[model samples]
Target chain A: MSAEAQTCPALDAKELDRLRGLCRQARIDLLRSIANAGAGHTGGAMSLVEIVTALYFRVMRVDPARPDWPERDRFILSKGHSSPGLYAALAARGYFPKERLSEFDVAGGMLQGHPDMLKTPGIDMSTGSLGQGLSVGIGMALAGRLKGLNVRVFVLAGDGEMQEGQVWEAAMYAGFHKVSRLVLIVDCNSIQLTGRTDETLSLAPLAGKLEAFGWRCVECDGHDLADLVPALERAVAVEDGPVCVIARTEKGHGVSFIANRVEWHAKAPTPEQLAQAIAELEGAK
Target chain B: MAETGLTYTVYDADHMTQAEIYGAVLTRLGGERPDIVALTADLAKSTKIGKFGEKYPERFFNVGIAEQNLFGVGAGLALAGFTPFISTFAVFTSLRAAEQVRTDICYQKLNCKIIATHSGVSFGQAGTTHHCTEDISVMRSFAGMTVIVPADGIETAKAVAACCDWEGPVYIRIGRGFEPRCYENDQYDFQIGKSIQMADGSDLTVIACGPSVQHAVEAAKVLKAEAGLSVRVLNMHTIKPIDKDAIISAVHDTRRIITAEDHSTIGGLGTSVAEVIAETGKSCLLRKLGIPDQFAIVGYPDDLYNHYKIDADGIIEAANAIMGTELEADEDWEDEF
Candidate 1:
């Protein structure tokens, strides 16, 4: 068990294996949900599975029973297009029934096209428009401090979403204020809706830009549990200022054909493709 | 301190602008309700929200000229169970960060109070960029958004305090400074979505908001004394969920209606009244007295108001013009489109 996992259940070897198995199932769950909906951001959602799994199952102090528990740590999925990933995580962690996962983007369903906090139980903030999650995280962090509550705010934003000017505005505010207990986890999938983020707008010196904004920057392999767990722990341990964990990841990480593919950014898989994708995921150790 | 427990007096009303009263009332409320918080986009001093910042240094957040993040943070705080009073210029709030106000706050229906200062041509000297003549139009269109344009300092204080009890999002527009006092005190019954009848008349009805209410009242008095024409002046403070009954009654009793506002005629107080009158299927000569579809030339706010024909003179002229027009004698509503 790593010392960092003490806040939740200890992340021992068995627990790690269990979480890895859960990640595999969550990816399958998300793929099926997206396929059923016939439209979703499959690439981005697949890329976020490991990170969302780590937060919900291991790091965040959230109780599925009491979704509005005041003292629980807050997690905001700023990259709201990848809601299937978050919905899968929440369902796996018992936030809602697993069968409800198929209702993504369905009219009158609790699950919206983007993360809606008012509808979804575990969602801390309603976010779909890019670059807004971080600022909202700052607000929640400040609120937690004002109320004298022991809480941490975590925001997961897509690397492409960092292109938005408001992201830097929030970064500047958080860095200047040294907003404590706020962690920004940037999923550097390197691909956006149009093409490679490098082609769209280069974020080459991504960590450097965050560093200049006064955030303590850390890099990690976003998919590797060993790397992701420690990086998140280090972020939670920071007391002086805001921290940014630049998780280097691939856009369509797991499935071979979908991996790093731009066309798959918002494409739902066909039934045959879904079966193949599930087989690939299930076959992985 | 009357029924609402707000402390704005006639003396304070004499010295303060609507924004100043808003700041004072917010700071006072901060002391009372621990859940209350204030936010600004580097506009604390200009918007008078700095008053709260000075008193509760920890509670007030200045987002450093980022209006988008300003409202975003305000929405976030509202999500965390805090009633956030976010302030910025009317231009920044209604236009610059309009989407954030719509998606992040109003879409979720967060408990956020947007105190937008320098609304309409209130900051007329700062040019068209700063003078927001479209806020009432933009904010009123949002679903579940409560829009209030207070007449003066006392009314501004009442609005600031009253919104704390109300849920969902509220946009309170006020002037920069030195708006003439409308009400002598806060004793008059003030409620959200309800209009206060400043004066009663039958010849013509002049509905106005913000500083225009005072002008309408003065114009009503002048018309009553000189021309022997009685004009009803309605302080249509709440733009959204506007006082429709009063407007309908005025349309029925007086066959003439004139809307005076310190805003563009496109989408504001005038347009709201026009919408009600149009739906009533009644025959009334409706004249809109406001800035007519053009960027206002930079000048003092009072001069701009007078030039744009939203002042007492403009209301009087509009009233006299409207009274001359003959109403359709046929009561058949089936043919009028």
Candidate 2:
């Protein structure tokens, strides 16, 4: 085990591989859940699987028994539409009963279409409106700093959600205050809901922009556990300013048919498609 | 009967404004409460919370010109168990950071106090955008918000100190510089939802709050001396959870009501009072004295108050107008009840 992995009580290579397998299962589960529901964001959720997996299973010091533990790290999914992946991860971590995963988007289910902190067990902040999750995360991190708590905050931002002016406002603030403990991970799938991010609104040279904003920037292959583990370690190692991990990821990753395609951004899979995807995941395991 | 038990002298100190009192009170409270954190959006010196910030550097946070981040950070700190008192001009806190306040603090029911300084036309010279005449109404409409418009500096101090124990979200509005002092010392109990009756009269009731409350008191004296109008003056400081009993009783006995506020005529103290009267179905002669349905012209706070007719002279005029008018009493009022 690497020294960094050894230091992190929540994560290790075995856990990482297990989480990768879980990530594949989560993607398959998301596809099936969305397919069952007949609608949901698949592309973004697919891209975030690895990042969410790493944070929940490996990075964050969260207690499933005490969801509201004062010193526990907070993770805010800014791109809240992509919640199926998060819901699956929470179920895997035992935040809620695993059976509840099947009830996603169903009537009177705790898991709504979007993550609601009041309703969902693991959600730190209620988010649906884009460009709002960062501000809430900033609040959580600021709360930690003020109270002299050792809690760190992690916020996942969609490449498309970066178009919001408020995101830059928060970025400028996090840099100015030197919020070292705050980690902002960008799921750079290069595709948004409508079309390609560059065609929609060019956020080219993403790492350079974050570096200019006084953040230590890191780039990693989001799906490769080898790259993701070291990058997350480097991100946590920085003790002065905030860190931004620009994880290069494929939208709808692990699914050959959906990978790198924008059409499957929110498309649900059919029963046959679900069976195929589950078989592929099981084959990988 | 000869000696009243522990009679406390209520001082009538004059000249100091509510904003100044807020500063002084915040400074005093900082000594007692260490968890009380103050923040400003680069308006620290202007908003008067600078006094508190200067006294306690460790407990102060200046987000610098970003109102949205200011409220967001404050809400965050509040969530972490720190009593963060965010200060800024009323205009910025209400309009600029309205969404942040609504979503981050009020929506989540966070224990944060937003001490908005220079509310209403107090920042008149700063132009139409700076004037926060609609703040009371906007804040009152927000869920889980405790809206308070202190009468003067002393009351402002009292309100700031009282917010320590106040649960959930709170918006405390104070005026700009050069306000007349309302209280002598911190002797009276300042409750969140209660009203303080400054004067008793049977002829007419003039309900006022914020900077306009002083005008109502002054107008009451003028009405008594000049027009033989015994005006019942009420410093209705707490705009939300408004003292309906006081309004209803005043309407019953006085048969006339005049509401004066340093806010817009729409959705402010006038609207709050009108809603209560409407619910009771009491037909009392009512006139709202405040800024009309238009953006106030750029000038000093005093000029704008004069222009909006929410000053002492305006309060006198509104009282007389309501007094001159007569409402037809319901013939079957008792039968309906």
Off by over 4 Å in 1: A1-6, B1-5, B332-337
Question: CAPRI verdict on model 2?
Answer: medium
lDDT of 1 by residue, A1-285 (tens): 322343655667887788789888988999998899899999999888889988888788878888888888899899999999999999998889999998898888888889888888888888899999998999989998899987899999999999999999999999998998999999999999999999999997998999899999999999988788888988988999999999989987889999999999999999999999999998897
Query: Candidate 1's residue-wise lDDT over B1-337, tens digit each?
Result: 2224577889999988778888888888888888889999888899999999999999999989898899989988888899999999999999999999999999989999999999888888889899888899999999999999999999998888888998899999999988888886768888999999999999989899999999999999999998999888899999988999999888877868899888889889999999999898777788998888888899999999999888999888888777777766865644533
How far is each candidate from the true structure, as Cα RMSD in Å?
Answer: 2.4, 4.2
- Model 1 misses residue B82 by how many Å? 1.3
Local distance difference test, each candidate: 0.89, 0.82
RMSD of 1: 2.4
| DockQ of every predicted complex | 0.79, 0.52
Reference-based lDDT, residue A283, model 1: 89
| Predicted structure 2: clash tally | 3
DockQ of 1: 0.79
